[model samples]
Target: MAAAGSVYEPLPRPCAFSPRSRDLLAISGVDGRIQVWDTRVAALRREYVPSAHLSATCTCLAWAPARGIQEAHQKKRRKSEAVDNDDPYDILTIGTATGDILLYSTVKGELQSKLVSHHRKVNCVRWHQDNGCLYSCSQDKHIVEWNTQTYKVKCKWKGDSVGVSSLCLSPDGKMLLSAGRTIKLWDLQTKEVTRQFTGHSTLVTSLMFMPIRAAADSRSPPETTGLYFLSGSIHDRLISVWQVRTEMKQKSAVLTFTLTASPVSIDLAPSDSKEEPMKLAVVCRDGQMHVFEHVLNGSHKKPLAPTCTVQIATSGGDGDSTPKPVSILSAGFCPDKQSMVLYYGSSMQPLFEKLVLKTDEPHMCLIRDVKKTLTLRKEMTVTKVKTPVVKAADTKVLMPGIPGHSATVTAMTVNSETQEGKRKPGDQEDTIEDRLGAMDIALPKPPTKTILPRADHFSVLLLQGLESCDSNILNKVFLINNETEIKRTVAKLPVHCVVPLVNEITKRLQGHPNGAMFMVRWVKAALVHHAPYLSALPDLGAQLGSLYQFLEMRVKAMQKLSRLNGKLYLLITQIGAFQMAQRTSMQSSKQAKLVYEEESSEDEEPNKEHNASDDNWEEEDEEAEEKEEESEKEEESEGSNEDSEEEMDVDKVNSDVDPGNESEEE
Candidate 1:
């Protein structure tokens, strides 16, 4: 077993490709910036700096589909060939920290409009793939549906206590699912929260609506044959397949299957072959990219486990046979059905590559040399260069996920009956000489100027202070490579340090203040609503109540301290007056006693006065005892005041956590 393992080393680190297989239009984060990448050449095309809400980070991005072809044709008739419908046109909408949703045009790269409706951070935004409607969920605990054409909010549905992390619209746009901890499904037409899914034990990270059949299938029935939704959660490490039950009056759903993986991202394959099962590409935090093939077996009446698996090689080393796991940050299906692209990053720059899958076995066939027959306008055109043609049998097996240009053949086959090359009626004799034998041919001359595709323009909002790099300078830098290399520039942004204030306080206090503490109160009221796990815990309500009480007590104590300070000022004033009066009275009494004693000694005799003092001394003893008790009570009050000062010190320390300053430095 050891020898066999040694022979099959782990996979190598995936090769990075600059020219991506698919278009990446928009990227955003909490640090108010939006980056756009050109898919063709892997370059940064353009940057947009929105003036409003520059401090808020962008959380979600969505694209709205273009209108019909007639409108596109009319626009193209005007000298706007660049604006023609050759490229996909869509409305790009982004959600930000300030709960504002900004919409822009992908064709013109212009900001179309903005919506300032949500009260808190907007977490997710989804545009109806088949309609002009938009759906957004925020930390405000509400999901709003909007008419993209009129820019009006059509309806709103309240979510659970916690903010939503992800949202998915059914393929037909009839239903919408907002998931955080509990998955809440809403009827879009009726604008009501219809059903709640409660199987996941943790926060749901991603939700996707996978079509049961290809979206282009005209024969698919709207009610039964369209799409089913799949939900993936971080805590549960499971992917739950859900389908709306038509038999039920309310269109309730049931979970079909749960996979054992924390799917951080998912993408469906774009194949229309009926025999080909739906493919789900899942990225788990365990540094593994799992490709699951959903098979609907007729006999079993349920979906089978993945039919085939492809483990991505992450680490770059000799262990190529035992595929090293990698944390796949994001993944998407390419427009071409042959490949899928995945994006990954660690502490270093983000890397991108394509994974091609083999759909057919190798076969020996003949490929005609079409280049020899066709001629370009220029005689020395690169497209007209004639290359030798080989019988497909001479070629080798092609593995999926390997680049077409450098693929190595694993196997080969040649037909003995077709060993003699025969020309067809249309085939020319001169062109036949170029086949089956190496011949000296003149190389094609290189063109004087290489024509490159026009750069796609996009806007990037720079974080505050990042503008010191001159929005123009930053734009120039990003646009250098058509925005494809923009991933390298992400390091220039200020690194964000995010720590829950309540968690920090809890750690500092080592479990003091119970639920009613000031820190606990802030978390329950302000942060819990934003947290993903708020709805998952059963004791959240009681915990929040205790936290509120702790906050109330702290507030009351602060108010009492203010009142006590005022009373202390009055006591100090009275003490000053008493001290002044006692000093004056002591001086007067001493002088009077001396005078009396001198007169007594002079007028009578010392012996008679001394005998009378015993009666006066007995009365003085009771007055001295009362004075001593009063001094003891005053000392106790002074000690209590000192204890209050120490408590104040603790309060100041607890309240001085500055998140903004700390994040800025980081």
Candidate 2:
């Protein structure tokens, strides 16, 4: 028997294989091109430039399952119209740097749409088998849902404060699992966060959901299958399984299993086959692949230990000669259930393959096919088994800000204009009366006088004490204050300081320049109220205060710049509106000047023309009489010209028609 926890020597680095069934094997090269090798005679079949223009590395790749559909329709004439056709071979979805997702069809060997919705580098992409939707997560801290048919965004789920590193969909397509530092479960139907599982101390690298069973137990009243979620954490080098019980009122979920190795990727065996038990495949950072079979007891209600474990060799050599194991970036079983493949490495040529138990493993190896032996007995027992009376516990925890302050709470009131309840100004007479009536009779009126805390309260007491102190002493005080007030403030420090504050204090105590400046700014902000001593300690107080103020101003400026950049981006994208606004401003200015000029000239024109109107009217009447006689003569000449043109047109048409008649007579 193999040692209980012995590490296996993996195959050599940069190894490639073609599965026994597949004719073409895809290998991603360091040059950012996918090389397709014909394994039948073990040679290169074709080299496809999926992303030849991209300089960034390819992070992940997945092939969609080929689905066959058969539809039966009734025609308008009462005849049955049946059509059956196999869906096109699943497209290959590749995720790369620059946050672009490319889909390629294997049948056509042509590139499909390039999904460019993600703002940052895309980390992973997964296709939902049942819905044919693509889910992709990126370093932009966003997970996008895509419609595979239309290639349009269906929806987007934003991550909380961190870039998403991995994503997975449940078997039923009802739940979406995503991971970064925390694991979040989303209900696809509601598009709301269902639950957040916080167990990993570091980043969660990968996640997979166990498959649900198909048929209900005959003896039981059709019990629904339970859901199980698995996650890999980098900090603890552990694999955790979480059981999700939707039936429970509280949504009872808990970690069920934890492994020792850091899992980089995980995949569960397809649950379609009744003869094969469910299995989990996990690839670890140590360049090892582990597979475990799911075992069920007689009741088929509780989970048992894995029946068997297989650790495949991925890289090889003695400890001293062997290079450090690169992470297994991704792993998946083929649709035919013949073999599995895994991609590992940080660079472009990261993918590697391993041929585990083949499709014939069950039929050829009798001892290994445990499910086949128990198939008959299991069916008989399952059919006759009686349903057990099980009570589900209430798992609902009160949501924050429901009715009263149950936990930590804070409140802020907005002005009446901003309040959710709309009320006109000066229309609160009834509201005031109702509030007064609701007040307790025994309660005394609160003090009307406002109290301003003393200036000393706002003064930087720590800075005053540290004045003229050495840098070492100031550093010590800063450390102490950081420890003390860290919990009081809600604002999170930047990433560079977070690890030092939370994980390592001693390592950062080396008095770095950045840390010194941070301490000085903090101390200065603390000492602003010491006006009396400010004159005496001008250098310390003034400089520190100025520095503090400068930092604050810089941060505000950055925020403003970000807002301005967003506006500029919007302007560029919305060209029509921007152009219209510019045109409207120009037109308004010109119109304003024209209006002013018209107003000034109006008086001059009216006065000058007013006196000449009587003389002009006499001349106009005489001209009108003479013009009418000339106009009648001109009208008669124009009418004769129009009549002549019409006659010519009619004669031309007759001549043209007569030629056709003559030809027929001849």
Candidate that scores best on lDDT:
1
TM-score of each: 0.47, 0.43
lDDT per prediction? 0.53, 0.52
Q: Write the per-residue lDDT of candidate 2 for residues 26-95, one digit (tens) a residue.
A: 6565434565543333344445542232333456776665541111342242121112112243356777
Q: Which pairs clash in the backbone of model 2?
A: 10-314, 10-315, 11-314, 11-315, 249-395, 250-395, 250-396, 460-526, 460-527
RMSD of each predicted structure? 30.7, 36.3
lDDT per residue (tens digit) for residues 1-666 in model 1: 011122111111211121223565455421223455554443444344433323244556665554511122243334553543365544567776567898765455556678878977777787776766788998778888887666778887677787777888886778888886588777877777777767665557678776655446566565564446778765455567765554643232344433445555567763354456776766555545556655532223344454334444433334444434444556677766557775654312334456675434221121222223122212532221122234454543221222111222222345674576775679656655666344566678998999763333222333321324243543343233323233333323232201222323333233544423333333333353334433332223322433434455568789999999999999999999999999999988778554333333465664566566777876667877888999899989989998999899877775576656666778
| Candidate 1 segments exceeding 4 Å error | 1-21, 29-31, 68-85, 214-220, 248-261, 270-276, 297-326, 346-349, 358-666
Candidate whose TM-score is highest: 1
Candidate 1 local Cα displacement, residue 119, angstroms: 0.8
Ten-residue region with minimum lDDT total, candidate 1: 1-10
